[model samples]
Target: MIEISGKKILVTGGDGFIGSHLVEQLVDAGAIVTALSQYNSFNNWGWLEHTACLEKINIVSGDIRDPHFCRVITKDQDIIFHLAALIAIPYSYIAPQSYVETNITGTLNICQAALENGCDRIIHTSTSEVYGSAQYVPIDEKHPLQPQSPYSASKIGADAIAMSYYNSFGLPLTIVRPFNTYGPRQSARAVIPTIITQIASGRKQIDLGDTSPTRDFTYVSDTCNGFTRIAQSLNTIGKTINLGSNFEISVHDVFHLVAKLMQADVELFTDPVRIRPVRSEVVRLWSNNSLVKSLTGFEPVVSFEEGLQQTIDWFLQPHQLTRYKPGIYNV
Candidate 1:
């Protein structure tokens, strides 16, 4: 097992929901961490600004689209967790080129940088969206790639680029494909956050798209843990592993569950604008997590109900709730 302590780690997109949580956990485990936030005039670090360990790690603001910049920051790092990407499905419909440049080209840049720097490992992030509507139950690592949305198409390309580096250039890399993950600090663009924020913001009627599509939702902490475990295992090198709960739940069910947990009586109404094109909608996703478990002996500890309640508790906080504008369709 590779010890996490004292290892220099670089997390691209460390300012994002999962990346910020991963940065915090790596710091707790004694890793020297550098978090990359997207460059902006205001110099904000996104969710990383709210973390307790913010003072302990270095924060770099830059875009992964630039190869020169990628090389500069990846230097001296022992491992690179490439979590940066353009992930919104709705936004991708309007601006697919942005997704390609950031997700596909950006991954190519990271892989090249890691190779030049001789990093020990690279855990490239992948989403379950690449699987599209599952053809069978318990989608495994070998599940066929079907890109129903532009965002998923870009990710499929990104995963291929990362894997090609491992296969052709011998760069030690693992693709950590996580199913839908939810928790505190998640963007309101996601369903769980949208539901929680709307109710917390005093909306009696919740606007939603098609809610019948089911997903295998893993909590953010478990997803981060999976990333670390994948890094520690030598067997995971050059492998594509999945991080998921192997459980499935639909958006309609999740809405009712969150409403019950928050003690709010709400009505859900389908908003035409929120609906995806019929052919683009991914109707089902249930993960087969046997690979990650066999490789690292990792199992998700948090139950779906428990995670949902925790998410509800966080969004209920007035200070946190104020940050989200539930009235606006977030995409």
Candidate 2:
């Protein structure tokens, strides 16, 4: 692997929660970073609006679903971090076709463009949700892919698309599958933000979906590090790696932790509208990230309590808190 200091890097979905943080890290590491912000008439840069390194990056506004746009942004880049997708689970149920077009077709565009442009490496992002409920604790790369929702199904297809390019065309590629990531700038659509935003809004009764499900949460910074670490390792090429803290916590416990940290007395209320269909809900997920450890010596350094406190502090900020509508279910 070459030095990232002067390398050209393109980050699709660069304005999203994890993508924004990753782009900042790339810039800080001295890489020439180009960020893809979804085109909007307002020209807002999503989460990148609050990024300190905004002036240091080249921001392009375009949809990933556009192959011509993907090809245009993908050219003259040493590396591409493909993270664009329709990620909300509930939204996936309502509009799976959109997920397929964005996640699956978008990945196809990126991979094809990377191959044509001679990009050295493509770091494709994956989610732990691809494994659905834990058939076994600490899910590994070899674990069965149980697409419990359209979102996961779309991701599964995307991962396959990326890997196929590597297998057939020998395009350098690696899939970095990070578990549930939470931190500052994460949209209210995610559960962690939902919980934090609701509590911060002075809601006496927290509205949540299924509380029984557990997830492996990784801090955004740690996940970004995982991507960079994986990208730099040649051995990770043409492979799928998982990024996660081995620890797991239930959604109810998450609410409890946040409420305790906020010093707010709140009762949890289950909202029927928020719940997923019986078969769609992933009951549990704990990642076996030993593969990434062996390959890149990467492990999640942030503890759950510490990360949650940091996230809560971020959402509690006046400017940040105002962006979220805590009174409504974001999904």
Candidate 3:
């Protein structure tokens, strides 16, 4: 393992769900962490605001869409983790321009900043959504990309831009493509949180979209470890690696699982507004994590049921559970 004892690192979306967990882990690894929280009037730092590592991190509030801010934040950093982007699929359909500006252009800004500053490495994040629906089981790194929605298209564009930097200019970088990650601090926008919150709120009926789409879910800590492990290895530079649990479960089954965990008898009510467009919906996503394992010796440590129980425990906390309106559809 490459030692991160005193290295300075920048995380673009450090205040987000997965990013917050990664920041905590990096701090525990003894890195001098700098986190960028999207600028807001109320000075809200998202999930990072409540963390014990808040004081240990150098927090910068800025927009990644702004090239100047990107350059400023990336300067003198040993490494950068570019996790900032617009990710909601339904919102992407209504505001593709926003997605393009943030996901694609924001990545370009970060890459250019990295090049100018001579950063040692960059861990660029990617999503399995780029694969659309899985054409084959255990989708590997070589699986063809199919952008079924504007959100996935923007991610593909961002990945292409980041890879181009590595190919054309020799910018040291790794694209960490994490399949659906779920854990504590996840917002209501995600299915797991949505289900847990509704059931915990004593809702007999739950609102959800299509029930058949399956996804390979990785725990948040495992996904964060994937980022750090890839960044530590020079072999991962200029390559895209997948981080996943290497298994699959349908949304319907997930609902039953959550309901069982909560001991709540809830019925899933299909919400028309919750479903994606027919062609835009990704029916299945299964990850083949051979490349990540071979390259970094990283494997998911949490089981599906264990991770689900942990997530449910977090949401069951009074303050956390009261933060959302479980009666309403998030998107």
Candidate 4:
């Protein structure tokens, strides 16, 4: 237990999937958390709106692309967790420029703001997508990056920009790359959410893309802990550490296991749109998380089957299942 009591922290993208979970944990850890959810006319906080802790924390609505707002928010903060970005891979194909602007340019703003505010630490959230396909099994921090998709290319750019801040300005920034995080409050755009929603909606035929690719899926809570662990430890400054379960499973195997858990015999149908371009597809991804374990003693607490069960139960709720379009493919 790292003591974060009375520490002022800023969490960008605090409305989204993993970000919301981080906010919940930060609050429990006794931090004065300021959560920045993307601004909307509907005033929707996304997943954070449902959190019981929302009433106790400061929720700011703004876009990280605005450098002025970023600078203003960083003032008086002890730590910054930058996570705002466009993450849907399929949409990135159509809006590559948007991905660059949000992921790269937005990161630049956060880094600059953190520097100006003299923030003690800035934990930049990165993705394993920056490592397109596995050149070798159990990819480590030294793995070569080959961006196989537009989304991945943008992330690579973002990671470089973040590291530059550390190298040039001596900013105390750490990049935490989490692999394939899945859990409750996740959007239907992800594979786990897609499968769970389809089954919850009583779909007899589930739509899917290529099932050959493998991924290392970490639960949301574990991923969140990695961020806090890096923040609390001074040894992690200027380091790019991984937060993963160090386990791999194919899409086909995951779908089969999920079906068994639900006791539903569903058939999978191939969708051309759901499939990545032939060369752009990453065939496998497995994490080598020993670096993080050595630095922070961080390990995933939730087992795959246990996490899957929790996600399934949450999506099974009538209101949550209704939010997803089971019959249509989500981009």
Candidate 5:
């Protein structure tokens, strides 16, 4: 079994959703984890601030786009988990160039640093957004990359750059591609949180965009487990693997399920601002999880209903629900 014991690991963007959870799991597995957040004036650690494992990690604040910072922080690290990225598709439309700089160039910096430091492994995080809409059911690693939006295009670029390092310079790295990951501590901008926050805030009318698009949502913890497992698999280096539940659900269906569980009467209204341009929207996403299972013996441990219930309960807390502005259409 892949053991993380005593490994010196650096988690870029460990302050964010999946990254923070990964840090906690890695620490519990006995890895000496270093958590890095984007340098902010307020010194906020994002969700990492609330983690009970906070004291066990070495927290640092710096931007990965800075080459000097990337090189400095990655030095002497045993493994590097690169999770930093500008993930919002709507935001990418407004700032496509920022996505290129952060997603592509920032990734370049990390790969360079990892190679220079002689890091044992570099598990670069990738999103299924790179695959855009599924051209076919059970989209596998070989799926053609359709850049339906600026966000997916940048990730495609970033993934290419990462793999080149392994092919040319022989940098030890594995591309961990996860389908829609959702759970507690996710940003309000994500769909699961968006729906939960609006319902929790007593909004009878929920403002949403197109609800026809289908996504394969994997729980955050399962995605993290995939990363840790990939790191432990020596044969997975210089390869790309997927972490997903191999199931799919459309937005409309997902909303209905959430409403039933919460017993909340919420009406959906399509907001123009929330809808993606027709061509830019990914109409469907279904993951082919066989590769990950074959490689790492990893499968989602949590059922969709169970995970959703846990998520709904977390958002029900007044203090947590208050953190999101349900009325505002978060892009």
Candidate 6:
């Protein structure tokens, strides 16, 4: 097992929801961390700007699509957590090419850079969406890959690119596929945030897409813990593992639960604009996380209700709540 403390670590997409949280955990673990936020003219670092440990680590603004930039940032890093990807399923419908560029080619850039730099470990993020609607319940790592949407297809391609690096070049790489991870700082594009934000914004009617689909929701911290644990274990190298709570809940159920926890008397309605294309929708996702548990002895500690309540508490904060425009259907 590798010690994270005092190691030079680089987190691509550290400015995002999961990436920001992982950055905090890495800092707390004593790693000398460098976080990469997508280059923007405004110099905004996304959610990382609000992180408590923001000042503790180095923040570089650049696009992972640029191989030179990825190479520059990856140099001298002991571990690379590649979380940067174009992940919104809805957006992928409108811009499939962007997903390919960022998710597929961007992953190529990171893996190539990591290989050349000789990084000790590379943790590539994957999503359950790659498993599509799940031909079987409790989907295991061996579950067949079904690209239901351009987003999932790009992720599938990205996962393959990362794994190929391991297979062909012997790069120390692990694919950590996480189920639906939601919590504070999640974008309103996601269901949980959409529900909580709309209700918190005082809307009586909440808008959502299909509610019948079920997902295995792992809290943000648990997912981050899985990433860190997988990175530490040499046994996990070249392996693809699922990080999930091993519990599944429907979107409708999640909406009602969040409404109850937030003490909001709200009704949910299907917004036409929010629904995915019929064939592109992934109707079910339940994860079998035995591999991660057996390898790292890590199990998600947060209960669904408990995690929802905590998320609600965070969103209720005026400073945080104001950041969201709940009335708009975030595509």
Give the winner by lDDT: 1
Per-prediction TM-score, please? 0.99, 0.99, 0.99, 0.98, 0.99, 0.99
Compose the digit string of candidate 2's lDDT tens values, residues 38-149.
9999999998988999899999999988888888999999999999888999999989999999999999999998999999999999899999999988899999999899
Query: RMSD of each candidate?
Result: 0.5, 0.8, 0.7, 1.0, 0.8, 0.7
Clashes of 3: 0
Residues 57-174, candidate 6, lDDT per residue (tens digit)?
9999999999999899999999999999988899999999999999999999999999999999999999999999989989999999999999999999999999999999999999
Write one digit per residue (lDDT tens) for candidate 3, span 65-175: 999999999999999999999888888988999999999999999999999999999999999999989889899989999989999999999999999999999999899
Structure candidate 4, residue pairs in collision? none
Q: Per-residue lDDT of 1-331 in model 5, one digit per residue for the tens?
A: 4469999999999999999999999999999999999999999999899999988999999998999999999999999999999999999999999999999999999999999989999999999988987888899999999998899999999999999999999999999999999998999889889888888888898878899999999988999999999999988998899888999999999999999999998898888889999899999999999998998899899999999999999888888887788888766
The deviation in Å at residue 95 for candidate 4 is: 0.4
TM-score of 5: 0.99
How does residue 94 of candidate 4 score in lDDT? 91
**What is the RMSD, in Å, between candidate 5 and the native fold over all Cα?**
0.8
In terms of lDDT, model 6 sits at: 0.94
Order the candidate numbers by lDDT, best to worst: 1, 6, 3, 2, 5, 4
Model 1, span 158-179: residue lDDT tens: 9999999999999999999999
Q: Least lDDT summed over 10 consecutive residues: which range in candidate 2?
A: 1-10
Better-scoring candidate (lDDT), 2 or 4: 2
lDDT tens string, model 4, 1-331? 3357789999999999999999999999899999999989999998888898988789999998899999999999998999889999999999899999999999999999999999988899889988988999899999999988899999999999999999999999999999999999998889999898888888898989999899999988888988898899988999998889999999999999999999998998878889999988889999999999999899899999999999999889888888778777878
What candidate 1 gets wrong by more than 4 Å, as runs, is none
**Candidates' C-alpha lDDT:** 0.96, 0.92, 0.93, 0.91, 0.92, 0.94
